[model samples]
Target: MKILQRKRKRIAAVLFTLTLMLCSCGQHAKTEQKHDWKAEAETASVYCVGKDDCFLCGTDAGYFGQNNIGIVSLNSFAVMPVEINRYDHNGQLIEENTGAMQMENFQNGENGMTVSVMLEPDRGIAHISISPNGDATLDLASAASHLCCDCLAELVSQLYGSVNGIGVVNFSTRRLYVLQEGVTSFGAGDYYVHCDYEALGGEIKILVIYSSLRYENLK
Candidate 1:
């Protein structure tokens, strides 16, 4: 009877140890699952392809007045010449002032760099400023032609110029002001051009004046 009792006690001890080990393993698994859940929730759906592409992400990401500037896709990022002078001081051709867009690291989904472009018309000048916030603004020429009163006034109301309202101006006589808004997947700025021409009997003569500005932001 004494030997039997000893054997029973040993069996009980072994079973208890097995139970403890199983419980410990279960607890560890639960902890690991919790950690994985948190990681999945914080991960981003998209990623930058490279530094240059990253800079195109932040251009015109916000809503300004009536218009919203934003990147169409990650593929739009590319290196283009950066125009240093608003007016080609050396009488250089407009195409000669081109600059390249250099890509950099991603900054919280914002492009690490910024760019600016200016547009000047013969009768007036406009300033288009873009930032990483995707914010854009069009400061119109204070003394533009009265013919553009309604059109110009509407454009100033919003950062992204309204394509519909601008269509009212006679394209031939009315100088078309164009400002490229953003760069690549993340970049921001405005494209502005000033037209100094008049429509006479359906004929348009554009006066090539130094009234346009184009620039870039290296932030």
Candidate 2:
């Protein structure tokens, strides 16, 4: 009877150890899922592809306030030149006059890097900023153009899943409430698009926030 009792106790101990191990693994997985997307972006190679015409100050393109700046991963290399000039002399540099995002600029918290991309000599826009925490901000130009939608889609494509399969949709005047003039937000699958009208400055800002576990299955 004593031998049988000892065997039962050993079996119970083994089961308890297995349960603890399983719980620990589950918790570790949950933690990884929470930050997987950020890890990918933090490690991936990013490039700032800006137009040559608009890169320098006082160009003809700058006079018209037309510039297309692409902040993307190496996978989405396009026609634009990767080399960029200093746009925001006032903002803190990750390195002196680097004019590009660096590894040190990538972080998971409030102190994420923000830089300005000049449209012209006199006017500059804080157009794009990104963090290691899988979050980014694109301050769209005040002009209510379809290009803003394209820019958002382009950025999203590089960060999360491919937007190629996703249907093309425009940010209509009705949706942005351009006439109404206030902050409004709407959902787009795993992302949130926010439209804000700065009454004081008379400027329209479109902020896109990525909100989903799109990288939970990243291998």
Best by lDDT: 2
Off by over 4 Å in 2: 51-219
Misplaced by over 4 Å in model 1 are 36-219
lDDT of 1 by residue, 1-219 (tens): 999999999999999999999999999887744443223212321221232222322223112121112211112222222222223445333443234422222221353224333433322322322232221221122112221333333323332311111111111122223232221111122322232222333221122222324576679
Error of 2 at 214 (Å): 34
RMSD of each: 22.5, 19.3
lDDT assessment of candidate 2: 0.31
TM-score of each: 0.21, 0.26
lDDT values, one for every candidate: 0.29, 0.31
TM-score of model 1 (CA atoms) = 0.21
Deviation (Å) of 219 in candidate 1: 46
Error of 1 at 109 (Å): 24
Model 2: per-residue Cα lDDT over 21-64, one tens digit each = 99999998777445443333333313222333222221332212
Candidate 1 residue 105 C-alpha distance from true site, Å: 23
Candidate 1 at 15: error in angstroms? 0.4
Clashing pairs in 2: none
Clashes of 2: 0
